[model samples]
Target: MLRSTGKHSFTKSTVIFSLVCLLGIALTVDVFWATRSSSSSSVYSSIASNWPREESHVVVLPKAANDTDSEETVDDKANRVPQRLLSATFADIPAPELEWEQMPSAPVPRLDGSAVQIKDLLYVFSGYGTLDYVHSHVDIYNFTDNTWSGRLEAPKDMANSHLGVATDGRYVYVVAGQSGPQCRTPPTSNTFVLDTETEKWERFAPLPAPRYAPATQIWKGRLHVMGGSKENRHTPGTDHWSIAVKDGKAIEKEWRNETPVPRGGPHRACVAVGDELYVIGGQEGDFMPKPGSPNYKCSRRNEVVYGDVYMLDSEMKWTVLAPMPKPNSHIECSWFLWNNSIIIMGGTTEKHPVNKRMILVGEVFRFQLDTKQWSVIGRLPYRVKTTLAAFWDGWMYFTSGQRDRGPDNPQPKKVVREMWRTKLKL
Candidate 1:
């Protein structure tokens, strides 16, 4: 979150000048940040602070008046300044609009869902049914037939969305996440495993640090979950933990806490390559509960959506890696490895060039493991966030999540059931 400090006196003209500077930053922000950030340990935030606000605020600047007037009297008479207005536009047509492939539609629209591919089937787990309802069923899609073949019920006490899912190509693990609807809710520590071969679900050791959407991965025969929202939901947690597993059962009865991530937050990507574990593209702030609302309505506050990348070696030591071409978030489940590179699909950028709102990213990014470099490889058909992605044979397939309806919709409608695929260029 934007931790602002110190009071400063500003003239009306000075305030106007500051606003102009904020608006022009889009042109220089990349170069300015590049110098301050480096390849192995970069950090950044949405530099723009005058974004949207849930409620209007009164900015009382000191005013000049007759020399005889007291300083206190001038403060009382200062005029209020309306905040920078929100001037957002959208694309004319609906996005992720499907065409004639005749891909089968999912039974329901899901947001923030988790999925794992096993052989010819993709197992899609629980997510919010929409913005209000939570889903507890698992959907199975068969690639051999190109159809959603089956559905299974999840654990009785699993979070409906924001889960951390990892797989060993057979046993899929579902970790902590928020359990229900609304804001300001504590996340669940429940961890469960589903054995695909047997269609059986088993309970496992609970997560040591329950996170809203922690990055979970299986590296060198162990399960690691790291970096997500703490109990407060607004505060990011960097705590990391892991446990040994054999078949589908935990070899270790309890989790072992390891070195923490450099920065912590949800909506980040966790991928394992060789002896290293990498964390990429997450945000530090969240939509928080209002001061005194009856339903605990959430309001967007100051935040840091960053592309800083870090890697953990076999010795648990941290190493910085090249950051993304631009800051990205809401890509926790949308990253996968292909051709010795980590490919990230649609998500959101740090902030909009024209406004304070974070904008959906349409470009596809590739982080090359061999060269340790980042490049914009391609762009999505429609900008999206929290999309479930998988790479199979020569095709890149993705489904679910919110998609832009217009050219650049800031806030897209929640979730789509359509699935689309494109053959990778290789």
Candidate 2:
């Protein structure tokens, strides 16, 4: 009878142990499902809701475990990165308000300085400093740091002033520009390439001829240099030259003069969009002519500001586009290409020789290439000229340029160190 009792006890103990193990497993699974349900529901709710006003980014959620629908396959998930956040599902997010936001001032005040961006960094090259002082220092602004952390010196032979500048993401090519104690006295053909990674400048073959305020663009792996102030005058020539490159370096010091542009003007702004080069606003006619010069009869003290527009195709052909509504003499200002349109910001008009001051205009004009139309987008807070403009990640940045309050002050201030920027969403 005792033996029978022991067997029964053993069976009972075994049954209890099994029940406890099953109960623990069930509890563990219940906790896991509960946590997952709560977390996934929260994530979906946040993603489904409208994006916050101040939020500029969104975290994409992983696919749900049960999302095995044939229509929404794995390939769809792999292909959609930007669309996942910026698609119509997030349409409630308001477009960025278009306005100029002042960024941190550059370490050194400069005007007529050329600017270029590689990745997240912005580099400002040589320009006119205080009291019309010429500079060869390169000031770099780090977007990550939100500050100018370092400065690099240009090559000793670099003559920078309204010089043609271009970058192929690694090397910055500084082309012919004027450099002298006095403004616009001498132009140099010296070409200097700055390796951004090394912060060092190396000399390249000089331009065929010296050019000041010329427009430069890297098109089809070659440097296309166009109109600018030549020699001792503001005469713009139709010379268009291309410098070939191989393995990220200039192949030769010689420039192959391509088909000349349809027209010539000093200080024209040129930008490359795909295979086409768009040229805009320049000072065409000579402002000052000698007594025996051909243009002496029509030449005035100030060059004629133009609102003309032209496009150069891949075939080396030029096409004239709709002219600007108003002529601008700020020939050195930078222009932005966005949404198949061109945006021209602050630049100066003709100079007042009697007053010895130029009329600085803060007007912003946009050109729609498709419609061949013009519209006034907005205006800068103050009139500035000789400023350089660069676009990166949908933001337009204007670096320090000279600003003359003209008429308000007989002796107007010459330069402004303020850097202004605005969103391109508008």
Candidate 3:
């Protein structure tokens, strides 16, 4: 009788365990089916919400002037003047189709430095400064965080000003600039490569010639250096050189000399957009008095400055474009390919004195590459010179430059620890 009772209990326990397992399986099936049924619809809703949807498109029409003024005012007569009319062609557009915002300032003041964007961060390096009384420091600003941070200093005794910086998506190539004991000395052809991922600096092949104020741009997987000073402070060279990379190292190629710049001058700025490189205005060679000439003792003729613009194609051919309305030198300007136009801003005009007067130009201009025409966009809010400018995320950024004082005070000044951004609109 006891053995019979034990067998009966064991059979009942087995039946209960089997029932529990079956219930779990049924619940899992119900959950899986429910999830599978909703997955496609959920995905579709997410994509639809994110898709760009056009709102009302309104057409803008110009408004006519009020008829209250029967006769034109004196200002109207002034506008009618031939010279004034020509100047009116460059009139300031009251509103920029673009928007602007202020960003965090650099850790320190800088001018004549190099700025290159890697991903979302703008890395600023080796500018002339008064920190520790003239320094070579590297600082970086992140667009995502809108903050500034210091990075590795330029590699091994690398002090530079107005150097050319270019990048190939992974590594930043620092070309020649003014370095060494004298601030005006041409930079050693020494090339420095900064790896963005590792935050490391490596020295590469030296440039063919000691160059300063040279413009650097990357094209067809090679870095191009063009139009800079060669040793002499006053002399500018049109020689162009390129460097090819292999397996994360820079291999200096033969210096491929191109057509010398037609209007050869110093401090000319260049930028690469699409397949073309545009070279802008700079100061010409200094004018030395001729021997036995009158006014040799008292008068020194200034070198002719250029406001002319030129474009270099992939074939090494150059074509001149519309000239800048005002000739400028020692100006910190930036170039960007925006909405089918090449926009330029900042830089000091020849009419403004760099030492005594700080002409902070807020005026923005755009060059329609297709039409060879220039039009004013808007003015910058602040006055700055010798600052570094760069573009990222549809905004133009200006960082660290010199401020001009009135003629009474001629001492060199600093405009560090400030940053500004202007957004481009279509």
Candidates 1 and 3, the one with greater TM-score:
1
Q: What are the Cα lDDT values of the candidates?
A: 0.78, 0.71, 0.64
Best by TM-score: 1
Across 1-426, the per-residue lDDT of candidate 2 in tens digits comes to 999999999999999999999999999999998897688678766865765532433434444455455686664455433322321121112222357889888776777778777877888887878633778888887766567777998777788567788878888888888665344444788888888887766778788988877788888889888888777657777888998875447887688988887777676677788888888877765444445643233234556667678888888888898876555655454676678887777665545433334456566777887786887777665666667676777777787887655634322266667777787666
TM-score of predicted model 2? 0.69
Clashing pairs in 2: none
TM-score of every candidate relative to the true structure = 0.75, 0.69, 0.67
Off by over 4 Å in 1: 1-102, 291-296
Q: What is the lDDT of residue 338 in candidate 2?
A: 78
Show the colliding residue pairs in model 3: 109-416, 189-206, 189-207, 331-347, 358-404, 360-383, 362-379, 362-380
RMSD of each: 17.5, 24.3, 29.4
Query: Which ten residues in a row are the worst by lDDT in model 3?
Result: 83-92
Deviation of model 3 at 222, angstroms: 2.4
Better of 1 and 2 by TM-score: 1
User: Tens digits of per-residue lDDT for model 3 on 62-172?
Assistant: 322332346878755443323100112112234364466777878777766667777778788877565224457678888777888657777765656767777777788
Which runs in model 2 stand beyond 4 Å of their true positions?
Answer: 1-98, 285-300, 331-333, 351-357, 406-412
Candidate 3 lDDT (Cα, whole model)? 0.64
